[model samples]
Every structure is written in C-alpha cells, then in structure tokens.
Target: MAAWLLAPQFTRSCHRQTPLTACKSNLKNIGTALEMYSTDWSGHYPPNLNLLTPNYLKTLPECLNAERVTYRIATGLNAPLNHGRFQDYYLVECTGTSHQDVNIPADYPKYTGIMGLIEQ
Candidate 1:
C-alpha cells in the first residue's frame, strides 16, 4: 500500500528527468563527434553540426523536450577558438530554460542551456 501510494510520484519525477538525461547524453555524443571531425579536419571544427553526420555521427541528435526543439550550433566568432581556427563550438538548446531542474555542468554557463567542447 505504501509503495503503491508513492509510485505515482516516483514515476512523475523520473518522467520529468528523462528529457534532461537525454539532453546530456546528446551533448556528450555531439561533443565526441565534433572532436572526431576536428581530428580529421586539421584541428578545425565544422561550421555546422550537420557536417558531422554519416561520418562522425550516425545522425544529429535532437532535444527531447515538449517542444522538441532542435539543437543549435554556436561556432566561429560566437564561440571561443584555438589559435583562430574553429577548434571549439557551443551547442545550445532551444528556449534555453526547459532544463533547469538539474545542475548545469561546470564548463557550461548557468541558465544558458549550452554545451560545448572547449579546448584547454
């Protein structure tokens, strides 16, 4: 009886966290793809994420939110680069406020909903 009463709340919490988990996974995958692409392109990142498909990634990853927002790339001048080459890029989520229930990554700025590969 007690377990049954708490099941709904647990389910709802998990449901709410699903999108966030997917988003983080998507970001990590994309980051790996970007690094692979850069490794093949003389340390230069692609101008667009679509270039990663069929080679670095099987397909582009999308946000799993209610709006199903597509991820956006912020590269070149919009992102920090290494030695004037596009060695870094920022992948931003649409709407930017849909995933705030959890802690943002230390490398990622707060409330920006942006993830990226920054060359150290």
Candidate 2:
C-alpha cells in the first residue's frame, strides 16, 4: 500500500532527473569535442562551437531539456602547455533547469567544466 502511494512521487522525480541527466551527457560530449579540437589546433579552441561540426563533432549537440543554455570558453592567459602553441581554453555550460541547486560536473577534462543548470 505504501509503495503504491509513493509511486507517483517517485515517477515525478524521475521525470525531472531524466532531462537533467541528458543535458549533462550532452555537455560532456561537447566538452570532449572541444578538447579534441584544441589538440588538433595547437591548444586554440575554435572560434565558435559550430566550427567543430563534420570534423571534431558530427553535429552540434542540443540542450536536452533546457532552453537558453550558454556554452562559454574560458581561455587561459598562460602559454600553451603543448609544443609551441598559443592558447589554452576551458569549457563550461550554463543551462536551464527545474531546480535551483542541482549543479553537477561532467567529470571530463580533469576540471569542473559543467556549470549550474538553474531554473528558467
């Protein structure tokens, strides 16, 4: 009886989490594409995400659930760590979410690349 009563609540929560999970996975894949692009271009990230298509990325990944999400590139001022390169960059995503504080990392690039996906 208790299980039946609680099923609806669980279902509701799961629905919300599903989109968030998809968004996170998308962001992580974007980050991977960015990293690969930088490596091929001597540590300099592409001018925009579109540049990754058909090469580094097959297609631009969409925000799974959120609208008005922003992907930003933070360029490291220091010289490139690789051979005679010119730039270093970090990737971050600011996505729309249902909750205020459900931010999680994509766990890639050895840095905290995924930013908060706040309620819109």
Which candidate leads in lDDT?
A: 1
Query: Model 1 TM-score?
Result: 0.56
TM-score of each: 0.56, 0.53
Q: What tens-digit string does per-residue lDDT give for candidate 1 at 14-119?
A: 3565765666556666666666666677766777767777677656655665345355556554553223444344443333555555554323321112334321
Would you list the C-alpha lDDT of every candidate in the order shown? 0.50, 0.47
Q: Which stretches of candidate 2 lie over 4 Å from their true place?
A: 1-17, 67-70, 78-87, 96-120
Top TM-score hit? 1
lDDT of 1: 0.50
Per-residue error at 110 for model 1, in Å? 8.9
Candidate 2 local Cα displacement, residue 114, angstroms: 11
Evaluate model 2: give its TM-score.
0.53
Root mean square deviation (Cα) for candidate 1: 11.9
RMSD of each: 11.9, 12.8
Which residue pairs collide in model 1, if any? Answer: none
Task: Candidate 1: list runs displaced more than 4 Å.
Answer: 1-17, 66-69, 80-96, 100-120
